[model samples]
Target: MEHPALIIVDVQNDFCPGGALAVPEGDQIIPIVRAWAEDFFRQGYPIVTTQDNHPPHHISFGERGGPWPPHCVQGTLGFALHPALQLPPHAVCLKGEDPDQDAYSGFEGLVEGPEGHREPLASFLHRASVDTVYVAGLATDYCVKATVLDALKAGFRTIVLRDAVRGVDVNAGDSARALEEMAGQGAEIR
Candidate 1:
């Protein structure tokens, strides 16, 4: 039997509606994600949540000439997970805390440690014997898309819960295009 994991990507305050980089109606998906996470927890599957815990001077900030405004800065309220997201006690939180990298994918960033470990999402999933991954959360066009693609590349069966995701949609069709791209890469769009 194939085990599955739920990967909630970047459901931080900064991505919700009214935060710095608010995805329109991004907060709306909280209840849906929370319910799914709760069910997954009850089923004894692993639930992993990723957060954009960048530095104040992170390269992805517009102040540093990057595309986005300062968001999810380390130690800031914007860096915290949304108040409504009900993360389980055992839920693994992966933080993207590099100041120089724009970590759009949960699997692309390094976790802070003495050695600044490079443990990615796949490492956690594999450790839990997870073969299928169901992903949901904020900014469908960026982090969610990147995470899905990486999950597929890492040989997990990837599924995107469309209703549980919102997008920044920097461009008019970026969100739609991102979904298409993920599907093309073998992610099942539910």
Candidate 2:
């Protein structure tokens, strides 16, 4: 039978409050995400996570003329996953490792192999027989939205855990608009 998985996108420290690029109330989702993960874990469903791992001079950095402040740099505390957010054994996909890749979508990220090789998001899910994916994470306007859209494009039934998300809201209503866009693209906000 095809299994369903949970994709926890970009829940690292930097996206939380009191970090270099904190999302407003981003830390609020931890308990909800943890509860969902635990439920999925108990059911033997796979839990996949995404991290924003970038170099100091990543192209998305404002120092490099990109829009946002420096955050989630590789090897920094900001790059660490939120401490309060616990998980069971899960696959981790690291995004933005390459300087040129914005990698907003977890679909654009990769997971490590036994030999230190990397695997793409869709490939891993397909290999694991995952037919549906539920996404919950930071910045509804950006990473979460991108991941959900890509999941749909890759032909996976996608669901967005509405209460388990927060957004940077660079603009006043970007988060609301993003939810609409995701819903418009066939992703259900549950």
Best-fitting candidate, scored by TM-score: 2
Q: Highest lDDT: give the candidate number.
A: 2
- Give a tens-digit lDDT track for model 1, residues 1-190: 9799888888899898889999999999999999999999899888878888888888988888999899998889998899888677445455557787778888875433335454556676777799999999978999999889988999999999999999988889999999999999999999
How far residue 94's Cα lies from its native spot in candidate 2, in Å, is 0.4
- The residue ranges of model 1 lying beyond 4 angstroms of the native Cα positions read 110-118
Worst 10 residues of 2 by lDDT: 110-119
Candidate 2 displacement at residue 130 in angstroms: 0.4
Pairs in steric clash, model 2: none
- lDDT (C-alpha, whole model) for all candidates: 0.85, 0.93
- For 70-177, candidate 2 gives per-residue lDDT tens digits of 999999999999999978888899999999769899999997656788899999999889999999998899999999999999999999999999998888999999
In order of appearance, the predictions have TM-scores of 0.93, 0.97
